[model samples]
Target: MKTLILFVALVGYTQALSYSDVLEEEWNRFQLDYTKFYQTEDEALLRRLIFVDNKRRIDKHNRRFMAGKESYEMGVNQFTDLLPKEFQSQMLSSLNITEAEGLIDFRYTAPRDVDPPSSIDWRARGAVTPVMDQGENCGSCWAFATTGTLEGQTFLKTGRLVSLSEQNLIDCSNDAPYYNEGCKGGLELNALMYIMHKGIDTESSYPYRGTQQKCRFNSSNIGASVEAFIGVSGEANLAAATAFHGPVSVRVDSEGMQSYKGGVYNNPNCSDEILDHAMVVVGYGNDKSGGDYWLVKNSWGTTWGENGYIRMSRNRNNQCGIATIAVFPIV
Candidate 1:
């Protein structure tokens, strides 16, 4: 009987150690420090903490990629295990869309060149386009998108690049007339409206905390303002916005964006009118393969595609809603 009890104890210990080994492997595969999740060395608890569902999703992702079911590349990413589907929705479509917001029009202009530049990357053109930002666990992507466009406009107007504060909008816009959802989510139009009424402060003054907090805006410390913001809903308008102004904020259906590691993402399941995730169109460009693509700046940080950028397939009937819900702030 004692020998049997000792054998059971040994088996239990081996099982616990196995769980810890798998957990540690997954943690390292995700490139995340387990210390960030928890400092405790309780292997059993850590095994339960790891997202098993993501393991399932990762398996499916790899299967589809291997079978040529995905148009884009897939890899173990920062968000691979940390985010769930509901979290993805919160990250993308936190804004309540309204007709009033969509009907706003622009006095559109045609591209000066009969053939627009084959490649235009504002990042290389010396704009105060801020470095790629990480929204982290917060649903503050709307604020990041707003601040990105504001920075572009600020650069165009002052010839100086300034990294503006998304936190200022997240913390303060709740009381503003724009009906901001605060950190939960917000619309670019409402953000622009908030900026028009009350100018936004700089990142230095009110840095991003990646979560909602109390309003602490000092009107006296305003960093940027827009002369006006116009909304457009087509490929021609997006082209005009990029050529006439700088980067423009737009939304597209981010159905399969979570696993998007690299490549010209062309998802058939993506929605064109159901605008969800907000990003910026810095310019339109072509790849070396002669394929046309839109140069977009994402707020998912430098670790994401093309170093915080995504080259989206362009002129494909506004593929992924790239043409729909396009708006820009003019400084």
Candidate 2:
């Protein structure tokens, strides 16, 4: 009896070791896939631990999805290693728009009175450029969002889809009246106003460095210039504006998107009062099973969500502030 008990204990110890080995292998593979390089061994170990914990949560969430208890699925991506707070501070911008700022006066023009189509996709209309990756530790989503709206407007006007420079806004747009603080954080309205004043440069002329630097904006290489901007509110108005205009810049609470993989995303934690990340509304449609969803383009890269896009819950009382602050530039 004593021998049998000892053998059982040994088997349990071996099983624990096997589980540890598998987790280590997974950590190694994740690092290799993402090209993650840690500056110190201690940092790498801490990241590995965080990765394991995140993986566990992701697996549990997926299980719930499989059981039809959840609408969306969560999976591992580049953000699996970072803690939630760390991810928010690094990726999301600190949006501090006062109530007065929210009030759009003469600038906010309603779209032409016409019923919008059942669905609309700006990408299919030869407007949207390819998805872009905003590198880690940078809160410059506002720049990307602003550029996307301008890129669409430019295409519609010039019959050419030219990618504009987010780096230009990041480096040059931080000043009075339009204070876009480069990677630290910024606002789409401010970036758009800066472009309206000083025409933007092309992405090829001024490439993205993922960091703020000395302004290298050249007026000679102007890619697109914004004449003015129009703001709209409410689900019906946002849809109408997107259908008539090109992609619209909007803000949302992006905390729920850290590990988002696929499916129509909806989280109770998402609120319009805490809009932290900016993105572009490329299209909107209804998922029969998932209900209505707004197809949004994120700047986190092609590997992040549905090829750098997310289908956010739409027409559900303005989930994630999709209609709270929507604006589009007129090129």
Candidate 3:
């Protein structure tokens, strides 16, 4: 019986070592996948701790998803090493409504009363440009959102789908009045105003650096110019405007979207009042299984969500404030 007990203890020790080895392999794989670098070993250890915790939560969430308890799934991504607060500080920023002193209201430029289709995708219509990555630790989602909306509108007006410059807005719009602070944070309406005053250039002409620098906007290389922009209100109005005009820029609470993988996102923890991130509403549709959803375009790269997009719960009391401060450029 002593030999039997010794054999059981050996098996337990072997299993424990195997678990540790697997965890170390996962950490190594994560670092390699995201190209993670640290200034010191201590910092790397701290980040590993955070990443492991995030991985645990992701596994738990995905388990719930597989069990049909969750509407969406969570997975390890580039954001796995950062805490929620760290991720928010590095990636998210809310729009300041108090700064909007002079901008067109939705009531004035609202689309004519028309029966919007049950579903509409601007991508299928050859209006939206390809999804873009905002890069690491940059809160330039507003710039991407602005460019996306303009690209769609430009396509509709000029019959050309041109990728506009986010770097142009990131650099130039940071000055007084516009207040678009590059990677720090910015407002979408402020960005629109900047585009109206100084026409933006093409993405190829002014590539994205994901950093704040001196304004180098060349008016001669302007890609698309807009006469004015309007701030839309309500989900119905937002849907109509997107269907009629094209993609619309909007803000939302992206607090729990860090590890989001796919499916109709319906986070009960997400607040509708706290709009923290800017994205474009590319389209909307009713999922046969997941119910109604707003197809949103995120700038977190193609590896983040559904090919750099998220299907947010829509028409459910303005889930995540998607329709709170929507705006679109008029070409």
Candidate 4:
């Protein structure tokens, strides 16, 4: 009887030890997987795990990865001293700038009626057009976004749409007292200001081969021009957007935008503040679901959003910063 009792106790102890060993192995494996996954910082995987599972573990990892990427890019730019001297001064001054947080509330204003015949439609006026992209791996979004809007406006006004070089703004705009390097973000307003003051040339005159190049200023044939800059207030901007025929520049929170799939994103329940990023507003209308959405064009490749664009909720001032910033009609 004594021997049997001792044997039973030993077996139980061994089984418990084996179970602990298995658990420890799993924990280590999970740690390894997480490190490798986040090291690459794949946006698609982060979106899938974050939205589908609401996995807090993965969310923490994603934020770390994004921070790492931002830090790495900033460090590289700093080491190389890639930005123009003038832009660095401006970026340092604007470091504390932040956009409004939470949902914005306002009334929609009816759009102004501009006669179609009297105005030139840039979209219809051109046979060939320049392709635009979001400045990924670089903080040159302001340069790209502003150049795109001007390109369209130039086409409408002059009936000749020329591909304006972004490299000019990247290198030359630094001459302004407030400009920053391509690593730190900048405002589209400043970009336009640079064009009006310095005079921007055509892409052929100053091509964007990427990387920092010598400053080339050709004041003689600065192809395009800006008529005016119209600032919109609150949610009312949506109504103002529909009336315009050409592109309008606006800000948006693009942090999680990398993973957005097809859906009418309406979550008044989120607690965290959204990050502000700029994008072009191309068109707006109601969709098949009988819900109104704004047709927005993004800089990320077409595979990212609804073919490089998204139809955000028009009624709510979320998704893109629809209620914030100003939209202008290039007269």
Ranking by lDDT: 2, 3, 1, 4
The collision pairs in model 2 are none
**Residue 248 lDDT (model 2):** 89
**Candidate 3 residue-wise lDDT, 98-205, digit = tens:** 554245554524456567899999999999888888887889999999999999999999899889999999889987778777899988788888888889999999
Tens-place lDDT per residue, model 2, 159-253, is: 99999999999999998888778998998888888888899999999999999999999999899997778886788888888887879889888
1-331 per-residue lDDT for model 4 (tens digits): 9999999999997877864464445444544543323345475354333333323333444464456421110111111211223223322112212422111122234455642221222334461244455333455656666776676666656777688777777777765553645535666666676676676888778876445557887877576665555555454454454344466666655433344444443334321234345566555666555266665665544444555566666666453455465444354
Local lDDT at 210 for model 2: 93
Residue range 187-260, candidate 1, lDDT tens digits: 87888888888899988888888778898898877899977887766787677678667888888887777756
Candidate 2 regions exceeding 4 Å error are 1-22, 99-103, 107-113
Count backbone clashes in candidate 3.
Answer: 0
* Candidate 3 to truth, TM: 0.91
Q: Identify the runs in model 4 with alpha carbons over 4 angstroms from their true place.
A: 1-131, 261-275, 318-320, 329-331
- State TM-scores per candidate: 0.81, 0.91, 0.91, 0.59
